[model samples]
Target: MKGRGQESFVSLPRFAARLYNALTHTQAIERQHREIARDLVARLARGRLLDIGTGPGRLLSLVHELNPELELFGLDISEAMVHLARKNLAGLNVNLQRGDIRSSGFPDDFFEMVTCTGSFYLWDGSEECLEEIFRILKRGHSAYLFETYQDFDESAVQKALKANLQQESLVRRLVTPRLLMSQLRMTYRTNEISDIIKRTAFADSYTLDPTSLGGPPAWLRIRSTKPAARA
Candidate 1:
């Protein structure tokens, strides 16, 4: 968690890594990952994919299940998270590494698509991170970012709550709402996110997607592209 004026980047601690891994396994969280995976899988036929802040690497693992041929990579600032991602992604061809997004070590124009979910809010150097994303992403390709928003669509929240009430897991029904409320207070609004991206090289090349799933319509799914090379 990072405050508005925080100067330091915060990585989840080892203990928090364990707890987060467990929480992501719950039915509600799994559903969220699946929605993201399905969308990503449907968009591209084949290319390299990078998941920044790949906590526990569950989303990459789910993506792999749908499309085994796609080259998958996961990066996180937390060594514990990288270790857990490697463990969870075992037996799969996915690559997992520990690195910060402010200045990722990947080569320029490398990845076909990049994704960061639920992690963009914690970045203290968002502009730097977006610049790095632009640098590593191939021209004409896109990066998908999903972050929590403070002013989420109220009707969507009620719909999500109703869906959760029908779920069998007691924890999902009770704990998810509380978690959502806490995250809403800590995260950005769509306009704030828009402003940040506008300050980066990706300015004029991003759009917001309305379709998202998880706890509610609280997730802002922004797709930003590196402009294609002209002939």
Candidate 2:
């Protein structure tokens, strides 16, 4: 993230577009990333899905693999992201909303499936975000959370903190997922992300095997369900 190549264009308005271009433009690297996205989106297949932190709506296309009738929606805080997503998915019957997942304007039980990938770990509170996920999902709804887990060793994280990526810029040296999770005091093991869901409004939750996301990345994908009201 040093040179003006891809790092300089990320100035709020062009941030999302830059993010999308960086991932999609890389030929040798992008296919693996897309395949990983494909797997995560497919596993949470359900009607009326919502994508959180959907950077440029690339993964939203994966819904095509599921029942064609399935509906899709996405939310992102970046205007550039919104514009790109709208343009990229114009022909499809999908809804693209510009909003924050933490304070989403949607009503309760609005969707059957909710997905937040490649961006959930950037948020401030893991618990609060989980609550918001539960609130917006319908009874018996399922949510898929994709994020980075802090590793045990300190060197692995210290290396990512000094990057110049948008969220991981130099000014924010400790911006890597490892440092971010540690700063947030999130001590849950990778396996415990699911259990964290069950302790909330969701009644059941479980972890899937480490999915092959096809990138030089280590991401955690956890699925959970919101149960019907207790008697």
Candidate 3:
């Protein structure tokens, strides 16, 4: 079991692993998303908190720093990411694991809160993943899904462009347009994400909040819950 997990980690592309933090770190919008996620977890997370796609575990680390009493667990598919996350979260009692969200090995009703940020589009099995999340969450508790879309509102695109121009260095500023274009190519539409959510076990058990992260209008949040009693 451990070897299988480690194998996946070992196969992570070096550049992808290395570039993950740098790309997210310099962006104003990325920082806003991370802050919003951390705040959400701090306010609502109790008992065990599991953060999926916890690349470098940055957001989890921030949440732990703010609310030291909450237990933290992080799961990511990349070995290099887990390694960096371990180092980033060293001294904290965080359980960092390498795994896929569609088939996490945790027991049913285990986690009090679950969070996935900035990685939903990478998931190939969105329905399965949501089902897995629903299975693991304690009844009456919820999972938070935060994603940024490519096809954002016009106002959001303008705000993001202005923020990038102001905050990034001159060289980095020149790259913003290209990067944003690439992101748009890869991102899913808001309706596409919502449709995936509606198709899962969490159908009719979730709420969508667009632009709540206060950055790009492209940022959307979904709060999905497991019913207190199975019908």
lDDT of 2 by residue, 123-210 (tens): 5455677788888898866777766554434454344323323343443332334334443344345656655555665545555444
- Pick the lDDT winner: 1
> What is candidate 1's local distance difference test score?
0.83
Q: State the displacement of the C-alpha of residue 1, model 1, in Å, after optimal TM-score superposition.
A: 13
Pitting candidate 1 against candidate 3, the one with the higher lDDT is 1
Using TM-score as the measure, the top candidate is 1
Compute each candidate's TM-score over C-alphas: 0.90, 0.67, 0.86
lDDT of each: 0.83, 0.61, 0.77
The deviation in Å at residue 17 for candidate 3 is: 1.5
Worst 10 residues of 3 by lDDT: 1-10
Candidate 1's C-alpha runs over 4 A off are 1-11
> Of the candidates numbered 2 and 3, which has the greater TM-score value?
3
Error of 2 at 229 (Å): 4.1
Q: What lDDT does candidate 1 reach at residue 170?
A: 76
TM-score of candidate 1 to 2 decimals = 0.90
Better of 1 and 3 by TM-score: 1
Sort by lDDT, best first: 1, 3, 2
Error of 2 at 182 (Å): 14
